[model samples]
Target: MAVGLWLVGRRAATTNQPQLATWRLTLALPCLALPCLALPCLALPCLALPCLGSWLLALGSWFLMSDLDA
Candidate 1:
């Protein structure tokens, strides 16, 4: 799970005093947010068609959150 990996990685980084790894994670957060930022491209009304991909987003959210509780 991502949280487990993040926790283990954080503990390891703390113990190791890994400055570079900290920077890498910090940099990657913004890049991960880029797609979400661009998602406004889907907001068009007439031709955009919200119904087109609503189900895909639902399935994607479920899959993405599946490992959270574990």
Candidate 2:
């Protein structure tokens, strides 16, 4: 979350162009992909924690990146 926000902040600092907005969205997308990607590793309990944590983190990151009006 912190890093995503930091990246958004950095990008926002430069410009608010549609391209940059697209870039932010692109950067933010990994969060959604993470949970799905984690599924394959869930067969192992030890792998589950990190994947679950990543899923949660990514979900949170998506929210932080997404605008309410959007």
Candidate 3:
């Protein structure tokens, strides 16, 4: 989980286009969702925690970058 979050944070750091990043995250949902439907109990945490954490990290990175630009 830490490794995955670290990768997400690094990606968020390098990503210059916020809109593109938003779109990519949006697009990833269905891809994550379909697998979760197969095994709800096992997949929920697998789908939810990392996804939510990574997204929050992405948003935080975006906000921080915007703050720096201001």
Candidate number of the best lDDT: 2
For 1-70, candidate 2 gives per-residue lDDT tens digits of 4475467667776775557656555554444456554344434424554666877899888998796648
User: If both were scored by lDDT, which would come out higher, candidate 1 or candidate 3?
Assistant: 3
Question: Which digits, one per residue and each the tens of the lDDT, describe model 3 over residues 1-70?
Answer: 3354346556866876556545445544544554533334234533655565666799899999999999
Query: Which stretches of candidate 3 lie above 4 Å from their native place?
Result: 1-45
lDDT of 1 at 59: 75
- Worst 10-residue lDDT window, candidate 3: 36-45
Q: How many clashes in each candidate?
A: 0, 0, 0
lDDT of 2: 0.58
Ranking by lDDT: 2, 3, 1
- List model 1 lDDT by residue over 1-70, tens digit each: 2364377568768889577556545544433444442334324223222433664698788988997856
| Steric clash pairs (candidate 2) | none
Winner by lDDT between candidate 2 and candidate 1: 2
lDDT of each: 0.51, 0.58, 0.56
True lDDT of residue 52, candidate 1: 34
